[model samples]
Target: MSNTGFRVYLNINRPDPSLVQRFGGIAVASIADSMNRASCISGKIKPLNGAPLLGVAITVKTRPGDSLVMQKAMNLAQPGDVIVVDAQGATDNANAGELMVTWMQYRKLAGLIVDGAVRDVAAIRNMTFPVYAAGITPRGPYKDGPGEVNVPVSCGGVTVKPGDIIVGDQDGVVIINPDDAEDILGKIKDVLVRETKLRAEMPWNGSWVDEVLKEKGCEYID
Candidate 1:
C-alpha cells in the first residue's frame, strides 16, 4: 500500500551476453555445488516450454497478480535479455498470458520468468521460447501501477538484480550475480572436470561401495 504511485527506477548495467551464454551448456545441478548450493530459485518455478533460458536479467518488482509493470519490463528489455518478474509468488491470479508472451517473442527476448502464475500453457508449450513460472492458471493479470523495473527483485527464492546472468534448463533456474561471475566460472570449470572423471569411472565401479565398506572395517551379521 505504501508508495502506490510511480517510483523512480534505477539504472542497471547490462552484463556481457557471452558470460551468460557460457552457462547455457552447464547443468544447473552441476553448478549448484560451486554456488555453495545456494543462489537458486524455488523448485516450484519451472519452464512452461522445455527450451532452456540464458540471458542477462532485466529485473522487475511488481504487485502480485499484476502485469502492468511486467509490460513495462518487456518494453525495456533488450534482445537476448530475460525479463525476470517478482510477483511475490502469487497463485490466485496470473501475472501474464499468451498475449504478453507473443509480444516477448516479437521483441526477440531470450526468455521470460515469473515468480507467480501464467496462463496459455498450451500455446507456450507449442513454441521453443522458454517461459518459466510457478504455476499456470486460466486467470489473467491486472494492469496496475506501483511496481519497480530495472531493480533488484526476488524471483522464486533467489534475489536477482539487473544485469545478472540468468540461466535455466529442464532441471531449474539459477541466478549468478554479475560481480561473482569470474569466480563462479572458474568453479564451473573445476566441477565439470571432476564430473567428467567421475562419470568415466562410474560404469566400472561396481565394487566401489563394498571396497569402501571393507576399508571402513564394517562387518555384517545376519
Candidate 2:
C-alpha cells in the first residue's frame, strides 16, 4: 500500500449526532505528552466547534523525507475527513505544512494527525485548521514517492484505521475503533450523566479532598 489507498474493511458510519454531541470530545486514550495534557490534535475544523470529528481516518506511511502520499491524501480527502499520516515516526522532516492544511480546509476536512513533524506553525495555529503532530519544525518534507495512505498506522502510540472515530481537543487525540463505538458511547454517556449531577451539587468546593478529610475527622489548618 505505497499509494493513497482507502480502507474498505472498516467504513463505519458516523456516530449518531445526538450521542456525539452528548459525549462532546471525550474519549479515553493515553495522552501523547503529559506536559501538553489538553493539546489534542484531532478535531473537526468545519461545522465550527461541532463536537469534534465523529468518525473518519486516513493512515499514512512515509519515509523520512517523503510527502507524496500526503499530497494525494489532500487531493482525495472530502468534507468530514481526517488525514492520518504515519511518517515512520520521523521527527526530522515535516510531512505536512500550511499549504496542505489550506487544501484540507478548502475541502472541509476535519483535521490532520501525523506521526512526524509539520512546518508553518504560526499560520496553522492562526487558521481554523487543527493539526496534531509530534511538534513543528522549519525543515519541510521532500516530495519523494513510496508512501502509503489509508492503511492502518500508529500515531503517538495509537493505532488508527480508516473510518475510526477520532475525537480530540486540547486534551489530545483518541482513536476509537469502529466496532467499539457503540460500547464506548454507552460508557461516555454514563460518565457525562455522572459529571452533570456532580456539577449540579455545587457544594464540593474546588478540592474534593477537603470534603473527604472532614468526613475522616481531619481538621484543616488556617
Candidate 3:
C-alpha cells in the first residue's frame, strides 16, 4: 500500500492545547538548545515580520514552482495550524502573496513558513500575521501542482511531519515532535534557568575559558 505521489493525510494527532500553550511562551532558541541545537529549520527562512510564531504543523509538499497543493493545505488547516510548505527551496517563483496571506489571517491560522520565495513583500510586511520564507521575488507560482498535503516534508533542511510543533521567533524556526515535546519542554526549562543565572553574574566570567585553554595546553602570549 504505497501511495507514492499526490497523497493527502486528513487526520493528525496534534499535541494537547496545554502543551502548545506552554511551548508558545518559550523562545525558539531555547527549544533548539533543548534539542541539542539540531532541529532548527535553516536560518535562510526568515520571518517577514518580527512576530513570534507557535503552532501545530500542517505540512505541504508542493512542486518546486507550484502552489496548488499549498492552496489545498490552506483549506485543510485549522486555526492555530502553521502551514509549512516544502517548495524545494525555489526562490525564482513566489509561492504566495498578500491575498493568500489575508486568507490565512481570516482563517486565523497561527502562521506560514515557506521553504521558497514569496511575493507581495510590501503588503505582507505590514500585516501582523506571521510569515517566514527563504526569499522574495516578483515571480508568482503556478497553480497546477503534483503535490501532497499533511505528509512528511523537508523544509529549510528539517524533516517536518503533520502535527509537529513549530516554534518561531526573531531568530528562526524549529520543529518539535509532539511525542518528545514534553521532555524537550523540561530541558528548555532547565536551559532558561541556566541562562538566567549566567545573566545574573554581574561581571562576565572568563575563568572557564582559561580552564579549557589550560587543559588544551595552550600557551598564553602574556
Candidate 4:
C-alpha cells in the first residue's frame, strides 16, 4: 500500500489505551524500532515527568510556510488529545508557539508533536504541557492557504493517525500502529518482565558490563 493509504488504515484503527499503558514507553519504543526502524525519531524534546498525557492524537497537515491550519487544529482539538502536525519536515517557519500552547492548555489537550518548528521555548518549558518538535525558531508562521485537520500525518519521522495514543518523555516520540496495539502490548509486557530481572541482577559496582563482555570473549582495556 502507498504511504498515505497505509497511514489512513492505521488511523481508522485506533489503538487500545489500556494495552498501551500496560506496555509503557520503553517497551513501545523497542517494539516500534524492531518492526519499523524508520518509525523512531531521535531528539531530546520531551514532557515533564509524570505528566498526564495519554490516549490522544491531533493529526494535521500544513504547508512549509503556513500556520492557519494549525491554528484551526488548536481551536478544534478536544480534551485529552495531542496535536500531531505533519509539516513535511519544515524547520524554517514556526508552525506552533506560545499562544497556540495557551489555547491547547485551555482546552485541556494532552500535548503537541510537530514536524516543523515552534517558538516561545521558555514559555513551553515553564508550562506543564508536553511538546516535541524538530527545533525552535524565533520567526512565527503565516496562516494562509490550505491545511487539513484530523487527518493522518507524519511527525518526528513517524506516521501517526487520529486517536492514536502518543506517549512522550525525555526519550522522544514513538507512534503505535493502532491495529498492532494489542500484539505490541503483549510483546512489551514480556520485555518489561525481562528488563526487571536484568535490573535486579545488575551489579551496583558497575562491573556487570565487564563481566558480560568477558563472557562474550571481550576485554575492557584500561
The regions of model 2 sitting more than 4 angstroms off are: 1-55, 200-222
State which candidate has the highest lDDT. Answer: 3
Residue-level lDDT of model 3, residues 58-117, one tens digit each, is 999998878998998999989999999999998999999999999999999999999999
Write down the lDDT that model 1 would get.
0.85
Q: lDDT by residue for model 2 over 1-75, one digit each (tens)?
A: 622443223233454544434435454332222212333333321121223443377666677657887887777
Quick one: ranking by lDDT, best first? 3, 1, 4, 2
Pairs of residues at least 3 apart in sequence or in different chains that clash in candidate 1:
none
What global local distance difference test value does model 3 have? 0.92
For TM-score, candidate 2 versus 4, the one ahead is: 4
**Model 3: which ten-residue window has the lowest total lDDT?**
2-11
Q: Measured by TM-score, how close is model 1 to the native structure? A: 0.88
Overall lDDT per candidate, in order of appearance: 0.85, 0.65, 0.92, 0.69
lDDT per residue for candidate 4 within 109-161, as digits (tens), equals 87887888888988888888877777778988997847777786767656777
Candidate 2 lowest-lDDT run of ten = 42-51
Residue 122, model 1, lDDT? 93
Which regions of candidate 4 are displaced past 4 Å? 1-38, 44-53, 204-222
Cα error of candidate 2 at position 66, Å: 1.4
Instruction: Put down candidate 1 lDDT per residue, 74-184, tens digits, no spaces.
Output: 887889989998888988799888889999989999999999999989999988889999998998888975788877788888889888898888888888888888899
Error of 1 at 69 (Å): 0.9
